[model samples]
Target: MFWFLLIGLVSGWLAGMISRGGGFGLWGDLATGVVGSFIGAYVFNLIGLSAYGTIGSIISSTVGALILLWVIRMFNVAPAAAKKK
Candidate 1:
């Protein structure tokens, strides 16, 4: 439980740095990390891949967070028509 939280924080920070330029603050990053953990596990299962140990978990979570950020950006982005207005 405790380890998961720590790993989530690290992975979230890393993902935020990679996807954007900085983190989304502590609580935001924590939320992203926790949600991304579930996403990562789901994705890995679908691909028949498994993450092992702490390092793998971090990597997986980071990847998931990146994906999550991308997805959020996609939907939240204004349409070209709206942008021009």
Candidate 2:
């Protein structure tokens, strides 16, 4: 549990930095990272890839975080575009 939280925090923080400027916040980042880890594993598995260990978890989380951010951005843009039309 401790390792999981630590990994989530680190991965989330890293992902935030890579994707945007910074994280949503400590708790938000942790949540995002944890969720992203699962997402990443699922996504990688779909492509027949698997990640292992701490480093692999971070990588997977980052990838998943990027996807999550992208989806959020898409939704954000859609509403604006809809309002314009």
Candidate 3:
């Protein structure tokens, strides 16, 4: 449990840095990372790939977090696009 949270925090912060945005702050990022870890695991499994060890886990979660953030941004943009039309 503790390791999961720590990994999530690290992955979230790393993803935020890589994605180039203000980020969701601490708690938000933690939530994002926790969810993203699941997402990453699922996606990797779907692709018939697996990551080994802690660093691998972080990379996987970071990718998932970026995807999660992108989806969120896309939804936010969709409404504004509708409004513009």
Candidate 4:
């Protein structure tokens, strides 16, 4: 559990930095990272990939976090665009 939390925080911070040049604050990053880890595992499993240990977890979480952020951005854009129409 400790390692999981640590990996989530690190991965989330890294993902936020990579995706948007900064983090989504501490709690937000933690939540994003933890959820991203689950998302990463699910997606990777679907694609026949597996992540192991700390490094693997970080990589998977980062990829998942990126996807999550992309989806969030896409939805954010849609609502605004719909409102304009």
- Model 3 residue 75 CA deviation (Å) reads 0.5
What range of 10 consecutive residues in model 4 has the weakest lDDT sum?
75-84
The top-ranked prediction according to lDDT is 4
Q: Write the per-residue lDDT of candidate 1 for residues 1-85, one digit (tens) a residue.
A: 9889888888889989998789989988887887888899899989999999999999889888888888998888687798667
Q: What TM-score would candidate 4 get against the native?
A: 0.87
Q: Is candidate 1 or candidate 3 better by lDDT?
A: 1
lDDT of every predicted structure (CA atoms): 0.88, 0.85, 0.85, 0.90
Q: Can you give the lDDT of residue 44 in candidate 1?
A: 90
Candidate 4 Cα outliers beyond 4 Å, as residue runs: 78-85
Give stretches of model 2 more than 4 Å off: 78-85
Deviation (Å) of 48 in candidate 3: 1.1
Task: For each candidate, give its TM-score against the true structure.
Answer: 0.87, 0.84, 0.83, 0.87
Q: CA lDDT of 60 in candidate 2?
A: 90
Count of clashes, each model: 0, 0, 0, 0
Quote model 1's TM-score: 0.87
Better of 1 and 2 by TM-score: 1
Residue pair clashes in candidate 3: none
Checking candidate 4 for backbone clashes, the offending pairs are none
Compose the digit string of candidate 4's lDDT tens values, residues 1-85. Answer: 9999988899899999999899999998998899999899999999999998789999999889888888888767466668667
Model 3 lDDT at residue 28: 79
